[model samples]
Structures are given as structure tokens and as C-alpha cells.
Target: MLDIKFIRENVDLVKRVVKNKQLDISIVDSVLKIDEKKRKLIGEVEELRGLKNKYASEKNIEKGKETKLKLQELEPRLSEVEKEFLAAIYKIPNIVSSDTPIGKDESENKVIRSWGTPKEFKFTPKDHLELGTKLGIIDTELAGRVVGTRFTYLFGDAVLLQNSLYQFALEVLLKKGFIPVLPPLFINPDVYTKMARLSPETEIERYAIERDNQYLIGSAEHTLGPMHMGETLNEKALPLRYFAFTPAFRREAGSYGKDTKGILRQHQFDKLEMESFSTPEQGLVEQDFFVSIQEELMQALEIPYQVVAICTGDMGGPDFRQMDIESWMPGQGKYRETHTSDYMTDYQSRRLNTRVKTKNGVEFVHMNDATAFAMGRTIIAILENYQNEDGSINVPSVLQKWMGKSKIQTK
Candidate 1:
């Protein structure tokens, strides 16, 4: 959530951000009005409490009783107003960086650069689904029958490939000083709310274990981010980096009839996510470094991909700036999103109460989360890019050691 003081001082600018993000502009007015009322009520409550204490000290029982009654009346209202104020303020999105494009949606996202060239296949390239089926490595049809759509079972080399992806990413991140963690798959609703990704508006995108009062995490960062919630870190730990491997669950709500045939859009998928907390001044640079690591991983796989700067409306409310890596999918005849890096600045830290003690004072730390690899999508990219004419899939050279075979073919 944005600091209320910042919102008050830059009302116009905040409103512009709301408009650019395609949110209700009137939320600014609502939040300001509620803040004014809340502050007034707080003052009245404090004043009444002071009077009650003063009267009691002076042995004026009747006056003290009246003041106490007034306090009781106002305190409940103050509590209500405070809740209302928080709800309103949380609606305000983080201000986007000046360099971020001010466009409405993904269509307006700018492609910053690209790496590698899409291979020219000698035969008609098969999509990952067809290749996986022919190789007897992926079975969505059986998974769908057992668990419904957007689910799949990986057999044989496909499972090995996924594990290899995780191992490769973990090694890369470990050498870069990132601590690897296996975070909880479930999160308390309150903590999840403070993470600010799953709001009342987007809660449907996540799985809720209603009985347990917990929500299944849609990403590893969801759990990794709040590790130091409500704590202050020493400034010397300026950039605390971590990478987590977890099975992510998503409802895929409202995403029907899209990528319905493959593991590209699944209800359950494994991912390796990179998350970090840094001093404010180093936030943007930290994000760039994360993107660089993402590029390094993709390049090592020899997959052609482009870097895209996500437009305002295309990014999440907590993202001050966002970028994605879209790898070339020859089977799909287009580039598809395989990795994303988000620089949330202090937007998330402010809510999580995750702060850093600096030379000056304690302040909210900036947060960043990016994809090391979304196993399913990366696998799709590899399958399509490295498929042989006779329906075999050559493993990426880097993963060959782990797989112990250069190619995977039908038994």
C-alpha cells in the first residue's frame, strides 16, 4: 500500500496513476474524505480520554463518567473508520516508474530487446502437446479425466526434464548468492492479504482451502516474500536474495478457451522463483540484475526470446515496473511469456512491515520477485525449439548431464 501521506501530498499524481492503471479515479477522493474523518475522530477520542483522566484525578466523578461515556461512543466509530480508511488506501496502486510505458494493456507493451533467432525447422514443427503425446511423455487427457481441465501428468523424460530445469535454475541462483528455499504451499489469508497480490477483486485466481482458512499459493514468491514480515533487517544485509522451488496452484479463473490443449496454462505447475529485498536506492538496479539472470538462463538453453516492458494496465497493482521474457514458440508460431520480473519498490514491504535499519532511520525496504523458470512453459519452449523431424526432442546441452541423454524419443 502507498503511504497515506504521499497520497495526500500528491493527490493529482496519484489520481493520474489510478487512471493510467485503468482503476476508478474517484478512489482518491474517497480515501481522502475517509482519512479526514478518521483523523478527526482520533483527535476527538484522544481529547475525551484526556478529559476522563483529568476528571478522575481531580475526583470529579460525575464529569469523569460523562467523559468516559463519550470515549466509549467515539472509540467504536474510530475503529470502524480506521478499517474503512485502510481498505480505501490499499486500493491505491504504486506509482509507476517514469520510464515505464503509460499504455493501456499488453498490446502496448514495448519489446526492449531479443536474444537468439528462431530456428528454421526442416519439417512442420509440432506443438509441445503433440510432441509430448507422440513421445509418451505428457498426458493431459488422462489428467483431465481424473482432475478436470488444465492439469497434466508428466511421464518418463518429461518429469526428468522438469526436475533438471529446477536443478539448473537452483545452481545458477546459488552461485549468484541466492539462498534456496522450499516455501510452504499454503498461506494464511491475512498474510496473503498483506502481500497485496490477492485482493478481494482477484481472490478467485487463487485456490482457497475454506475449511483451513488458507489459500494455495499461486507462486513461490507469495510465501518467500513475507519471510521477514514485521521485522527490521540490518542495512548491511542490504540485498537479501532467495530462490524457491514450489508447486504453484492457480484457479486460472476467467481464462477459458485459451491454451486449453497444453500444459502452457495449467491449474498446477512447478516453478522456481527469485525474490529479494533491497534498500530503496538499489531497487531498480536489483530488478535489472534479476532480469539479467533470467536472460542468462534462457540464453543457456539456447532458446530465442525477447524482453518486453509491461505497460501500466498490464502490470499488477503492486508492480511499480514490470518486464517479461517471451520465448519463441515455433509450434505456436509466436513468442509466449515464459518469465517475468517485477520491481515493486516499497509497495509490498510497506504492507508487510518489512523494513531496513539504515544510517538515517528505519524505512520500508524495496522488494523484487522474478521468475527463474516456470518449468512447464520453459519445457514447452524447449520441446518446440529442439524437436527432431522424426518426433524426438534433444535435451538442451546444459541439462544433458542431468538427463544423461542428448535426446528423448518414443520407447
Candidate 2:
């Protein structure tokens, strides 16, 4: 949610964001009208309270009773208007950063840089599903029967490989001064809404535990971001960095018939996510560092990848600026998204009420969250990129120590 003052002063700019990001233009008008009503009601209520206090001080019982009656009538109206104002304001999306490319959808996204080269294979490469099935490590057919489509079971070396990826990413993040965390998998809808992860457009993609009124998180960042909600921190702790590994759930509601053959798009997947709170001056730089770290991880795995600048339409509503890393998938003969970095500035912090006390004054902290590894997708990249002519998968050298072997093959 944006500050109402900012919206009022920059109505045209906000409307431009709505148009560029493909949101309803009328939302701005609706919010401003409701804001005006709410402010008027607040002024009335305050004036009545002052009158009531003055009567009490003067011992004017008859006048005090009349003032109290007016106060009762106006207070409830003010409360109702406040709620209406909040609902309307929440619909306004964050302002887009000047550097973000204005475009429509993913196809318009620009590829800024690329690393490594796609390896030439002696034999025809197989997709991760085929390779994992042949190696007897993935059992999606049974998973489908037991739990429905878009679920899978990992056995033997596949499980080991997943753990190795988790540990490898954790070590790298730890070296970068990030504290490790294990966050709750479930979040209350109210907090989730404040984080801007829950909205009508995204409701279909989320899993709601209606009985408990909690929603299953789609990313660790969802839980990690609100750790300091409604709190103030010292400026010296300006950039508090944390990372978490969690099993994320998604409905894949609108993604019918897409990546349906493999774990590439699953209802349940594991991920390592990095989140940080920084002073406004350091926000964009923090995002740059995150993307650099993502590139470092991919390069260490010796996988080919490209860095993409996510266009306006393709970026998240809360993201002021965004970038993604797409890894080469040889079997698919193209690059697929494996990681993303979002610099939200103060958009999320403003809603979460996570503030920082600066030397000059208090202000909302800028927030950044990025994918350290989307385990399933990264695993797919590794399998497709490192497959052997004889159906073996060579473990990335960095993960080999934890995997305890250089290659994964049928026993």
C-alpha cells in the first residue's frame, strides 16, 4: 500500500503505473474519494471530543450529554469510513522505479547478460522427468495416484541431490553474513495481505486452510519478511539479512498444461530464499548484490545462464524493480527461469510497519527478497546440463562433497 499523501500529490503518476502495470485506472479515483470522506469524518469526531471535554471541565452536564450523543454518532461513522479507506488504498499498486523497463508481459522482457555456454552432448539429451525415471529416483506416477497431479516423490540419489543443493546454497549465504532461519509454513490472512502477497488476482494461486483461516505460504520470503512487523530497529542494523529454506505450495491455477510433465511446475516444491531490510540508499545496490550472488551460484555449478530484466507487466505488484536468472536447459534447448531478485523499496515495509530509526528521523526500511535456489528447477537445470551418454548425472563439483559421489546412476 502507498502513502495516501503520495497518491494524492501524484495522481497522474499513480495512474500511469496503473496503466503500465495493467491495473484498473479507476482505483485511484475511488481511493481518493474515500480518503476525503474518512478525513472529514475524523475532523468531525475530533471537534466533538474537544467540545465534550470542554463541557466536562466547565461542569455543564446538559451540554456534555448533548456533545456525548454527537460523539457516539460520529465515532462509528468515522470507524466505518476508515475501513473503507483502507480497502480502497490497498488496491493501489506500488510506484514503479524509473529504471524498470515499461513493457507488456514476459515476451517483452530484455536479456541483459549471459554466462557460460550450452554444452554439446554426444547423445540426444533427455528431460529431467525421463532421466529421473530411468534412474529410478523420481516417482511422479505413484505420487499422482496417491495425492493427485503436480506432486512427486523423490527417492535415493535425488533426495541426496536436493539436500546437497540446500546445504551448498546455505553455506554461500552464510558466508555473505546472512542469518539462517526456519520460518512457519502457515501465515494468517491479515498478515499475508499486509505483505501484499494475497489479493484477488493472486487468490487462485494460493492454498487456503479454510478451517484454520490460514494460508499455505508460496515462498519463505512470505514468512521471513514480516519477522519485524510493527517494530522499529536501529539504523546501525540497517541491512538485516536472513535466509530460509522451506517447502512452498502453490495451486498452479492458471498454468494448466504448462510444464505438466515434470517437477518443473509442481504443487509442492522446496526453495532457499534470501530477504533483507536496508536503508533506502542501499536498496538497489542490495538487489544488485543478490543477483550477483545468484550468478555466482550458477557459475559455480558450471551451468550456462542469462540475466533478464523483468519488464513492468511481468514483475510483481510489490516489486519496484525486478530481475531474473534463467539457466540453460539442454533437453528443452532453451533457458528457463531458475532465480529472481525483487527490490521493493519501502512498498512492503510501509504496509508491514517495519521501520528504522535514523540519525535524522524515522523511516520505513527498504526490502529486497531473491531466490537463492528454486530447488526443483535448479535440479532440472543440473540434470539436463550434466547428463552422461550412458544415463548418469554428474554432480556439480561444489555439491559432490555433500553428495559423497561425483555421479548419480542407477545402482
Candidate 3:
């Protein structure tokens, strides 16, 4: 949620940014109206409460029957006003950064730059689905029968390939001074929504449990983000680094038809996420650290990729600035996003109530998060790029030891 005060000051800018994100502006208008009503109620409620207190403290209690009645009359109204204020606060979206580009969808998104040319194949390249099945690495149909669509069973050497990604990502992140954490797998909506990078339009992506207050985490960033919730930390610990590995879940709603054929997207998948906390004084530096780790991971895996700065319209409120690492997929004949790095610049910490107290006093900490690795997507990238005509995958030199072979040969 955005601070009502900030929204009040930046209504025009908020309206424009909302348009760029391809979001509904009507809700934003309603929020502003609700905010106005709440503000008026606060002043009115405070005045009535002060008068009630004054009346109660007056002398000559035998003559105070009229005062008692007036105080009782004001109580219900004050309660009603507080309820409205709380509701308005919950609906407010965080203020987006000023630099966001004005556009709708990825087509409108500006490409800052790209890296590493797409690999040229001497032979016709096979898509991941064809390559994986032929290599005896992925069994989508059987797994779909056992569970459902969008689920897969990794066979042959795929398991080792997936494990190898986690091993490599964790090592690189740790060397960057990131503390490895195993966060809680589930969290209540109050905390989840508090730091989550979700919006009203994207609500379908979230998986909420009807039976309980908890929801399965979509990303480790959710847990890592609220770690300092409602707490103040020392200034010296300004840039706190953390890396986590977990099986992330999503409802995958609204994305019904796209990428349903392969593990390009899935409901449950493993990922290595990196999160950082820094003071306003050191936010960009912390952001660079995250970007560096993403690049380092790609280089170590020997994958060709490009880095692009996301336009303001492409980013949500929790992210003040964003960048994506897109890997080359020769089979797909194009680059696709595999990792994203974000600089949230106090947006999340403020909402989650995570603050730091320096010599100058308390302030919200800026947050940064990046995808160090997603096991399934990484596997897909590897299978497509490293596939051989004989249904084999030449393991990257870095991961050869982990797979226990130089190549994965289909039986």
C-alpha cells in the first residue's frame, strides 16, 4: 500500500503511471475520494473526542447528565470514521517512479540494450519440448496424467541439471556477501500483501488458501522482504544481503493458453532468489550488486544473455526501477526474460514497516531483489541451447562435474 500522504501530493503523476501499467484508473479515483472522506472524518472525530474528554473531566458530576449523553452519541461515529480510514489505506497503490515510460504492454516497453549475440546454428534448432523428450529428460504427458497439465517429471540427467543450477547460483550469490536463508514457505495475507509486488489487475496470479489465512509463497522475495517488518535496524547494517532457495507456487490464472506446452511456465517450480536491504544513501550501489550477481550467474553457466532497463510503465509500485536478464534461446530464435532485478527504493520497506535508525534517526530501507535462477526455466534454456542432433545435451563445462558426465545421451 502507498502512503496516503504521498498519493495526495502526486495524484496527476499516479494517474499517468497507472495508465502506462495498463491498469484501471477508476479504482485509483475511488481511493482518492475515500481518502478525502477519511481525512475529513479524522479531524471531525478528533474534535468530538476531545470535547467528550473535556466534558467528562468537568466538575459538578451531579449536573453532568447532558454531557454524558453527548459523549455516548459521538462514540459510534468515531468508530465508523476509523473503519473508513483503514479501508482507504488498504486500497492505495504505491507511487511509481517518475522515470517510467508511458506505454501499454511489452511492445511499448523500451529496450535499453542487449548483450551477447544469438547463437548461430549449423543445423536446424529444435524447441525445448522436442529436445527434452528426445533426450529422455522431460516427460510432460505422463506427469500431466499423474498430476495435471503444466506439471512435468524430470528423468535421465535433468534432475542433476536442475540441482546444478541451484549449486551454481548459491555459490555466486554467497560470494557477493548474500546470507543464505531458508524462509517460511507460507505466510498470512496481511504480511503477504504488505510487501508483495502485486496489484489489483494481477490478483489472479496470487494463490490464496480458502481454508486458512496463509497463502503459498509465489517467490522467496515475499518472505525475505518483510524480514525487517515493523522493526528498526542500525545504519551500519544498511545493505543486508540474502539468498534463498524454494519451490514457488502461482495460480497462473489469466495466462491459460500461452507457454502451456512446455516447462516455460509452471504452477510449481524451484528458484533461487536474492534480496537486499540498503539505506537511501546506498540504494543504487545495492542495486548494482544484484545486477552483478545476475550477470555473473549467466556467465558462469556459459549462457548468452542480454540486460535491459525496464521502463517505468513496465514496473509496479514496489519497484522504483527494474532490469531484466534475457537469455538467448536459439531454438526459440529470440531472447526471453529469465531473471529480473528490481530497485524498490523504500517503497516496500515503508509498506512493510521495515526501517533503519541511523545517527540521524529512523528511515525506511530501500529494497532490491533479483532472480538468481529458476530451476525449470534454466533447464529449458539449457536443453534448447545445448541440444545435439543425436538427442544429446552437451553439459556446460561449469556443470559437467555435477551431472557426472560431459553429455546427457538419450537411451
Candidate 4:
């Protein structure tokens, strides 16, 4: 949702971004052409309206009737042209930051830094699935029968552990000046459209309730991002941070045979998400702050992880820049993505009509959303990293109090 003026002035840069992001370059040309027609029609409509007004003042019935006919024809044509122009413009993605890396996919993503060290196990480690099953904490077999694949029911300590993770994440964000919110799990199609900038491809990934005309939210950010839709906020409240926990549902379309065993890629999962609204100058800072918060959470958990700068092609259309925090999972013998931060600039705000009244006048607010914790994946990291040789799971010190025990073990 870039400003058309910016797109018009920085055509070359926009083209380069489209190329780097693997988007349709022809869309840029289409937008310009449609906009040209739209502008011309608008001018013609205005001129005809003016003539109609003059004819009325002069009491010229014949001229007035002709002008009225011209206005009716031009107005509808202008409306059609305007619709085409808007559709074309929406197809254009936001310009990437100058510093954003140019690459085709995740393989080229740059790891800016890493924290902690991968643990060395003297004995073979079992994945979360095995550990949970042995400890009678996770039941996937029953869930498969009840809800189909990629679903699981946590029993006993696993339930406590997941809830503890939620509490811990909420506390961390609350201390950082973020207001906690519990948004509706179901959102109207209109709000979701603006929040996600729904294109045909993305629309397929959502779970739509056809009868209700609502879609299930895929993340807390989905709802949080549109909280101020079509509103103008006071600049004095520059940065409004919200932390939310929600049960997100997704169709998981096109993602088959990947992490299907565990809760990593589930049709339904819980997540703690952070969303913020800030002035343009503060967007990047807010992004960095979110990454810092992520790092802090990872460090507190004492898990090995890395911070990656997402390449152009790997980023979402609305993301100006993005980063992912991948935590080590010993059972999987690799690092798995646990959190992501997307700096959308004004891409989302423009569609949401979320603006702020600043000294310079009203302007679209820069929006950012990041995962504080994906509960299921975070639990996977915890289960794999904190497992003892004897099949007991040692709770992270920070969560021990909430769990009321230091270890989860079978009786």
C-alpha cells in the first residue's frame, strides 16, 4: 500500500524491488497506465459538472440537459477507471529498505548474530513427540482420531508447561510497556482484508466461515494490527504497543509433509504476538526493540538461537524488512523458527487507514508486528533443550515457579 506519489517518483527503485521480491513487474506499468486514465476521467467529470452548474445558473435548459447527460456518462466511467487504478496499485508491494539483502530465498538469509550455545548430549536425545508421549504429557494418537492430523492434546505437565510459557511471555511484554489484549479469534472479512492486504494467493491460506462471512485469525497480530482501523490517533501517544495471546487457526495450505508429527505445523496453535503503531521515524527502532525483546526471551530460556535477516524474496509483500529467530531443537538436530518480526512501514497502515496527527499534519502510522512466542514451537524448543537423560524434563528456572515443580517426570 505504498503512496502512489512515491511509486510515481521512484519508479526505478520500485521496479528493482519488484524484481528482487519476485513480483510481477508488469503490475507497475499497469498501475501507472490505469492511474493516468483515472486522473483524466476525473478531470473530465469535474469539468462537465462545472458546465452543468453554469447552465443551471443561466437557466439554459437545453445546455443543462446535455451537460447532465455528459456528467452521468463521465461519472460512471470515472468510477470504473478509479476501481481499476486501485486494484493495480494494491498489487504493488512496499519498497524494501535500502539495507535489505537481495536474495531469492531463505538459503541466502544472513544471520546477523547468535545467542547461547547448542548443548552437547552424552546420550541420544528424543524429540518432543517421543518425550511427550513417554511422559504421558502429549497425546497425538487420540487427537488424530478426534481432530485429524497435525493436532495434539497436552496432558498433565505439558498443559502446565504451555500455560506457563504464555504467562512468562505475557509478563515479559507487560514489563516492556506493552498492553495485553485478548482479541476475537474470528474477524470479519473486511477487517482481515485490510489487515492482511489479502491477495488471491493469501486468501486461500485462510479459513473462511462462508456463512458468517468471517475468517479465523492466523495470529494474534492479525487482529491486533487492525485495532485502530480507520482512526486517527494523537501523536503524543506515539508508540502504542499491544501484546496478545490467541488461538490461531489456518488452513496451512500448500504446506504438506512438513513437521506433521509434532505441533510445529498445526492447523491450530496458540501464540503470543506483539503489534505496535508508531511514527515513521520510529518504525525501525520499534522493529529493533522487538528483536531485542525476542533475544531477551531466548536468552532467558537459555536456548541456542540465531537472528536472521530475511532476504527480499522470503519477506511478505507488506514487510519492508523482516527477521526470524530460530531456536535450536536438539531432537530435530536443527534450528527451527520460533519467532518472526515484520516491519511493515506504512504498508498495512495505509489500508487500515490508521493515521496519527503529528506536527507535520496527519500521516499513516508505521506498523510492526512480531511473534513474542509461538507456544507450540517454543514448547518444542523447551522439550528438546531441557530434557534429562532419564526422560524427565527440567523446567526453565523462570517457569519453574508457575509450574510448581522443577521437573516433569512420569510417575
The residue-by-residue lDDT of candidate 4 on 179-252, one tens digit each, is 99989898887787687545687998888899988888889888899889999999999799999888988778
Q: What's the TM-score of every candidate structure?
A: 0.99, 0.98, 0.91, 0.98
Arrange candidates by lDDT, descending: 1, 2, 4, 3
C-alpha positional error of residue 214 in candidate 2 after TM-score superposition, expressed in Å: 0.9
Clashes of 1: 0
Q: Write the per-residue lDDT of candidate 3 for residues 1-411, one digit (tens) a residue.
A: 566777778888777666666557766787777767666766766775666567568764543565556557766776776666655555544555455555555656666656555667778989888888877778899989998988888876888888887877766667767799999988887787677545455567887776986788889998989888988888887688898999898878878898898888888888899888888888878777778778877787778888777765566656667778888887888888898888888777877888888766888888888898988888878887887877688898898867788888866
lDDT of 1 by residue, 1-411 (tens): 999999999999999999999899999999999999999998999899889889989999999989988888999999999999989988999999998998998899999999998999888999999999999999999998999999999999999999898888878888999998989999998899899978889998989999999999999999999999999999898799999989999998878788898999999999999999999998999999999999999999999999999999899899999999999999999999999999999999998999999977999999999999999999999999999999999999999988889999987
User: How do the candidates rank by TM-score, highest first?
Assistant: 1, 2, 4, 3
Off by over 4 Å in 2: none
Model 4 TM-score relative to the real fold? 0.98
How does candidate 3 fare on TM-score?
A: 0.91
Model 1 ranges with Cα > 4 A deviation:
none
**Cα RMSD for candidates in order:** 0.8, 1.0, 2.4, 1.1
Using lDDT as the yardstick, the better of models 2 and 4 is 2
What lDDT does each candidate get? 0.93, 0.93, 0.77, 0.90
* Residue pairs clashing, model 1: none
Residue-level lDDT for 139 in candidate 1: 98
